[model samples]
Target: MREAAEPRRVARVILLDPEDRILLLHGHEPDDPTTTWWFTPGGGLEGEESREEAALRELAEETGITEVELGPVLWRRYCSFPFAGRRWDQDEWYYLARTTQTATAPAGLTELEQRSVAGLRWWTSAELSAARETVYPDRLAELLQRLLDEGPPSVPLVLAPEIV
Candidate 1:
């Protein structure tokens, strides 16, 4: 058995536009650009900031979308993966947010993000389902469609570990 790494607490936003398309960031591992995936906009909490605060801050910094209506935590996940030469164990909270901003101009990005992030795009559930590329939190298309059909769940859904 392998040793368990300390979990890094992270807050991620599932940003949706009025058109219902979800925003996602396309990025790759810094150490291996060939390995890529599309993921939500969010990052780890800074200082004593709450997950909600971190979600908003990260969203603005990554996508320049600050004017948003932050919704509830829709999902939670414990994922472990390797990137940029280090292994990450992340306990993440996925919050739902709506924004009118369609275009993105990054306000701020850390060195790591600057290197890892490739682009940002809005994805319809159909596009996600048809995509040949990878998307984090597997089954995201199905999950998203579920959320669209039925509003946010009364309780946050606990997702299975994504170990890779």
Candidate 2:
């Protein structure tokens, strides 16, 4: 049996616009375009940065929206998956954020992201709930509706771990 690899810590932003729509990036594996999904804007931390800082930085880098109101983490997730032909185990913190900017002007995207990302879109809760394409952190629509209706949880909710 193969030993488990150390999990990568990632900070993700659930960025919502003034219209109550969430922004998601469409992306595929670097080597496999057919394997695709839509996900929140975020990335792994850099050089001892706090998750909040990483979350904000990633939001700026990935979405090109800098004016943001970062909120407390709404969820924590653990997932093991394959990307770029390699298995990745990630321990992720998902923060709730709001922005008025609707346009995207990505500032700095890693080579991997440049190749993987196809586009960005804002989706309403209803649209997300009915989406046919894959989205990470399963039950995103349900979770998001909860956030909209009740606001951020006082403590971060621990999501069920996933392996894909």
Candidate 3:
């Protein structure tokens, strides 16, 4: 049996607008521009930062919006994927946050993000469901719809794992 790679803990935010659209960042591999995908704002936790702290810090750094309120963890997932030049095993937590601000001026992107990230866009559930473009963690539309309709679970839900 193959041993699993150690997973890196990452904190992500499900940033919602007043219209309920979720914000996603578009990016592509540096070695393969044709390989593109959309994902939420997030990064690996540094040092001993709590999940909430990492989420908030990532949100502000990636989106340049600091006025939002961080809410509870809505979902968690274990995902393994190839990015940049390496495979990553990521244990990611999704936190809910709402913001009235629309403009994003990402000032703190890492060098990798600066090169790979194209831009950010707000997506509606319907748009996400119908999109032909790739989005990570598979069924993002369904997840967003469930969250919208049912609200956050009393306890954090473990989302289905993804390997891609």
Candidate 4:
């Protein structure tokens, strides 16, 4: 049997506007620009930080939007993907946050992000559902629709594993 790799715990934010559009960051591998995907704003927790703490900190760092209230965990997923030059096995927790500020100034990106991130955009659920380009978490459009209709689930929903 193959041994499973240890998963890195990452906190991610599902940032939504009052109009219910979701925010996503567009990124590509530094060495392979053609390989691109849209993902939420978040990163691995540092030290012994709580998931909420990491989510809030990553939100501010990645988008320059702060002073927003964060809601409960909305979703969870285990994913493995190749990024930069290494393969990552990640266990990700998704938190819901709302923001009126849409302008993003990614001033706090680490060197890796600076090299990999292409841009950020706001996406409506319809757009996401119809998009042909790659987006992380696979079923984001359906997930957002459910969240909009029912709010956060009592327990975070476990998403399908994404391997890419």
Error of 1 at 33 (Å): 2.2
Per-residue error (Å), model 4, residue 131: 1.1
lDDT of 3 by residue, 1-164 (tens): 99976799999999999999999999999777787899999989999999899998998899998889789999899998888889989999999999999899999999998889999999999999999999976888898999999999999999889988
Candidate 4 achieves a global lDDT of 0.91
lDDT, candidate 4, at 152: 90
Superposing every Cα of model 1 onto the true structure, what RMSD results? 1.8
Q: Which candidate is the best by lDDT?
A: 1
Measured by TM-score, how close is model 4 to the native structure? 0.94
Per-residue C-alpha lDDT of model 1 across residues 1-164, encoded as one tens digit per residue = 99866799999999999999999999998767788899999999899999999999999999999889999999999999888888888999999999898889986989999999998999998998899899988989999999999999999999999999
Give Cα distance to truth, residue 162, candidate 3, Å. 0.8
Residue-by-residue lDDT tens digits, candidate 4, 39-141 = 9999999999999999999989888888678999999999998887789999999999998988888888998888889989999988998999988888888
**Collision count of model 4:** 0
* lDDT tens digits by residue: candidate 2, 23-84: 99999988778978999899898999999999999988888899999999999999998888
Provide the TM-score for each candidate, comma-separated.
0.95, 0.95, 0.94, 0.94
Give the Cα lDDT of each candidate. Answer: 0.94, 0.93, 0.91, 0.91
Q: Residue 106 of candidate 4: its Cα lDDT?
A: 80
Over 4 Å off, model 3: 1-5
lDDT of 1: 0.94
